[model samples]
Structure formats: structure tokens, C-alpha cells
Target: GAGVSQTPSNKVTEKGKYVELRCDPISGHTALYWYRQSLGQGPEFLIYFQGTGAADDSGLPNDRFFAVRPEGSVSTLKIQRTERGDSAVYLCASSSRGWRTDTQYFGPGTRLTVL
Candidate 1:
């Protein structure tokens, strides 16, 4: 089975531009998550999706950030009106079941640079 994967390993965009980062989870995984990691810090939870609905999105910074897992497998993180502060390494992870103790497999992450 394939591991989690993220597309556009690196992204550079000017402030106010719109960008979409993608993630593909492991086959048969039913839970997906999106996180952001800034310099010198651990990954911060952004959103979590169980199946096609977002189970928890309280970690999203603001309305500018949104994510979806329509098919319960692939997900896309969309950023609107990007800001320099939004620059970070966007990580994606998935697990077989959405449990507090379930092991999550992480992707390499998409490094986003907002200029």
C-alpha cells in the first residue's frame, strides 16, 4: 500500500494570492488530518476529516484556510488571500481509524512560501 503523499513539495506565492495544496493518504485510511509547522515549532493541528465531513476544524487559523476530503482519501488545503505569516510547512497525515490512540502516517509536507 502507498504511504501518504503531498504534491508541489514547494510552493512560492505572493501575498493575497490563492493556493491549493494537495494530499493523498494511504489506501483504505479513513481518517485524514492537516497541520502546519513553522520554524522552530512542532506541527499545529489545522483540520481533521473523518470520511467526507470535517470532524474538527477548530485549529484552522481563520477563514482564509480551508480543507476538504470529499472522497475520504485525497484532500486539498486551500488558502485564500495568503499572508506572509501563512508561510510554513503544510503537513498531511492519515490513520486507519479516527481514534485518539491510532497511529498516524505523515507525508513529507508541502513547504509554502508566501512572499
Candidate 2:
């Protein structure tokens, strides 16, 4: 693909429901990251995956949030017991090298609406 692609571009669910957001990074990208953007706020980094392992996950608010990059190319963000506060635009990004300082191409994002 020419850029990162996220599945289910939009989602609406009631509180307490579970949701999964998928991200497919550009081929050959070695670093993948996940972020969440709420209305009127900038995107907040949630997790960073280098290759097949998570490099940083401290940005996850709580146990209800998690992400995985099992094969290094595709990643998934999982949410359990979704809350109205959890509604946000989940963005995925990828970089070819130097994750800390390299340019990261962002996806369109998955809009999750928790009612």
C-alpha cells in the first residue's frame, strides 16, 4: 500500500462494549506507533512497536487498552469495556528507521464512538 491503512474507518458502540482497531503499515516500515486523538486535543502517543515487539506502552491509559504487532508489519489496537470517554480517533503511524527522530507517516485513523 502507498500509506498506512486502518480498518473499520468508523465505529459506534455502547459503553462496556469491546472493540479492535486494525492498522496496516506501509510495507518495509520497521517501526509502528499508535496514538489517540480526542476532540479538541492533539494526538497522544499510546504505544510504539519496533519490529515484532512493543518498545513503549506507557501511554496506554489502563489495562483496558492494548496493542500488538505480532508479525512486524500489521498491528492491532484492542480495547476492552469501552467507555464514552474512550471515544476518539485512533491513529497509526509508521517509520522506516530511527523511530525516535524519523518521519512517521500517519494513517487516516479509526473513529470510535462510544455511546
Candidate 3:
């Protein structure tokens, strides 16, 4: 019955460093999604995973962003060469069953600060 969770809650890094954020989806959920929210903006989908494979990764902004869900439950979002523009709250969500469901319960989010 555990909800999705993201680690660090907050992260601070230099403009060119690498950072990894973790997400633990709820038990029994088959769909997981990653979204990024900048200041005063709606969350934008980054990537999504159905079971252990990525169902949609078109939202990834560039080569600097990537994610994986190997075991079909826990996932990690990795960013390389982090830029100042990358500073934002990275949110993770999960839902029951499959892709048609839009009810993605969210975590408190991991706030990334790039300087």
C-alpha cells in the first residue's frame, strides 16, 4: 500500500555534475511515470515505464536525461552534465494496471538545484 517515493527530497549540485534520483512505486502498480516541474509551470512528462520497459520516453529533453525501471517497481532518473536550467522539482508517479489510467499519484518530489 506504499505510495511512490523519491529520494534526497532536495539536491544541490554544480552545473556540470551528475545526479541520480530514485523512485519507489506502489506495490502492484504496473505503470510508472517521471515528470519535471519548473517554477510556476505544470508538470511535463519526462518518461514513462510500463512494467520493466519504457513505454514512452519521448518527453526526455535531451541526452542529459535518462531513466530506467529494471524490476518493474523501482526506478531511477539520471541526469548527466547538469545545467542551471535543469534546476527544478523532479516528480514521480505510478498508477494501477496500465497506460490508459491517468490517475498518477505523486510524491513530494525531489527538488534539484543546479548552480
Candidate 4:
């Protein structure tokens, strides 16, 4: 429809808690990506999904981070056992093609604060 939409613009949680961040990509865009941004650093790639399968997920720090695009349109990023170090802005993006296409649109990130 419009651009990517993220729910719960901000979140506050305690350590050991879990959080799920959602992303709704642009219509007809088949390439979706997730990124995490910490203070004083640019966004870091967390995963990339082409259609329903993940094309790349190497940027995910560990098993605690996971993503899924079961329907190829909306995706979700799941964080398990939240830590203070995990606090950051979770960004979602979508592109017409794939990596380095120069047309990726990013969403207003969900700011997660782990207390």
C-alpha cells in the first residue's frame, strides 16, 4: 500500500524478557530485510528474505535473534532472552529486487529499550 509500517514504535522491557517486532513491506516488493542500530553505529543487517525464504541471515548475532516471512509480505523479528546490550532501533526495509539495488525503503524503527 504505502511504505513499510512498524508496530509499537517504542518498547520497554526487562532483561530475560522477549520481544517481537513486526514489519509490513511495500506492496509487490518481494525483498525484505531487517537491521539493528545501536548508539553511535549505523544499522547492521540482521536478515534478508526473498519471498518466503531467507536469502541471508548471517548478520544475526546469535540464535536469540530470528526472523520469519511466512507470507512474503509481512515479516517479524523475534528476540529471545533480551539483554541490556540488545537495546537498539530495529529497522525494516524492502526493495524491488535484491541487495545493492539502491531503492530500498526503510521503516521508522521500533526503539527497544531493555531495562
Candidate 5:
């Protein structure tokens, strides 16, 4: 049973590029979440999924941000036309179910740097 994991840990790219950040949650857990953390601020919820469906994605900034959990265990966050403002730590987390009330386990995160 693995905890949550994210790749790269750090990503540096120019503006307008596209990047896909990955997340792997614990086995048997049906809930997954994605969030972005800017410097000096708390993590902001971007999306959360239960099973194969996106339970909530209202936190997504715009059309440029998207995510998928096709099989309900692994998730990938896709950012199109990466902007300077998009530079932040992309955190992935998971819990036992589709509720945030429960403690969520977080990944190391992928820090995106847009220049």
C-alpha cells in the first residue's frame, strides 16, 4: 500500500508550454485530490475525484487546468499554456473516501516554475 507520490518534484518551463503532473495514491483508496500551493500560502483545492468521476472541480482556475482519474487510483493533472502565474507546487493527496473531513495523505508535490 503506497502513499501518495508525485513526479519531478520540480519542473521548470517557459510560458505557454504544457506539462502533465502525475499522482499515485494508496491502493484501495477511492478518493483523490489535487491542489496547488503558492509561496507563503496554504494549498488551494483544485479538484477531487471519487471513483472514475470528478466529484468536484470548481477550484480549477480555468480551461487551462484539467485532470483525470480514468481508473480511479492514479491521476494526472494537465496544465495547458502554462503561465507565470501557474508556477507553484502541485500537490496530490488522497483519503479513504470522497470527503475532506478525513485526514488526507499528501505527496511530495511537483513544483512548477514558469519563466
Candidate 6:
């Protein structure tokens, strides 16, 4: 069985460009999360999905960042008008249950570079 995985392990784009980052969680996991890790900082929570709907998205920085778990399996993180400050490693995680105590398995992460 495959673990959590993200596409386009490295992405480079100009400022103000639109980008879509994809994540595929482990099969049968009900909890999914998206995080962003900036230089010298730990991964910061971006969004969480319990099923097909977003359970919490308070961590998203602004309107430019959005994520979706349409089928409760695969998710996509869409960024509009990307900025240089958006350059960071995007991470995805999954767990069997969406509880505070559940152990999360993380993906390798997608490194996004905005020029």
C-alpha cells in the first residue's frame, strides 16, 4: 500500500501566477491535513478535512490559499496570485481518525518556489 504522496515535488513559478498542488493520502484514512513550512520555521497548519468537507481551515493565511478534499481521498491546494512570500514546502498528512490524539503520517512535501 502507498503512503501519503504529493505531486510536483518541486514547483517554480513567477509572482502572481496561479498554482495547484495535489496530495493523495493513504487509502482509507478519514483525516487529511495541509501544512506549510517556511524557512527556519516548523510546519504550520493550513487546513484539515474530516471527510469530503473542510473541518477546519483557520490556518490558511489569506484568500489566496484554498484547499479541497472532494472525494475524501485526494486533495488539491490552489493558490491564486502567488507571491514570493508563499515560497515554502507544502506538506500533507493523514490519520485514521481526525482527533487531536491521533498520530499523523506525513508526506514528503512539495516545495513551491515563487520568483
lDDT of each: 0.96, 0.94, 0.93, 0.94, 0.93, 0.96
lDDT of 5 by residue, 1-115 (tens): 6678899889999999999999999888899999999999999999999998998999999999999999988899999999999999999999888664888999999999999
What lDDT tens digits, residue by residue, belong to model 2 across residues 1-115?
5999999999999999999999999999999999999998999999999999998999999999989999889999999999999999999999997356899999999999999
What root-mean-square deviation over C-alphas does model 3 reach? 1.0
- Report the lDDT tens digits of candidate 1 across residue range 12-67: 99999999999999998899999999999999999999999999999999999999
The better-scoring model by TM-score among 3 and 5 is: 3
The local lDDT score (0 to 100) that residue 47 gets in candidate 3 is: 95
lDDT of 6 by residue, 3-86 (tens): 999998999999999999999998989999999999899999999999999989999999999998888899999999999999
Question: Alpha carbon lDDT of residue 47, candidate 5?
Answer: 98
* Clashing pairs for predicted structure model 4, backbone only: none
Minimal lDDT window, size 10, model 3: 96-105
**Model 4 residue 18 lDDT score:** 90
Runs in model 4 lying further than 4 Å from the true structure: none
Residue 29 deviation, candidate 3, in Å?
0.7
In candidate 3, which residue pairs clash? none
Residue-level lDDT of model 4, residues 1-115, one tens digit each, is: 6998998799999999999999999998999999999988999999999999999999999999999999999999999999999999999999987758559899999999999
Off-target runs (Cα >4 Å) in candidate 1 are none
Each prediction's RMSD over C-alphas, in Å, is 0.6, 1.0, 1.0, 1.1, 1.1, 0.7
- The RMSD (Cα, Å) of candidate 5 is 1.1
lDDT of 6 at 12: 98
lDDT of 4 at 53: 98
How much is 112 displaced in model 1, in angstroms? Answer: 0.2
Better-scoring candidate (lDDT), 1 or 3: 1
lDDT of 2 at 77: 98
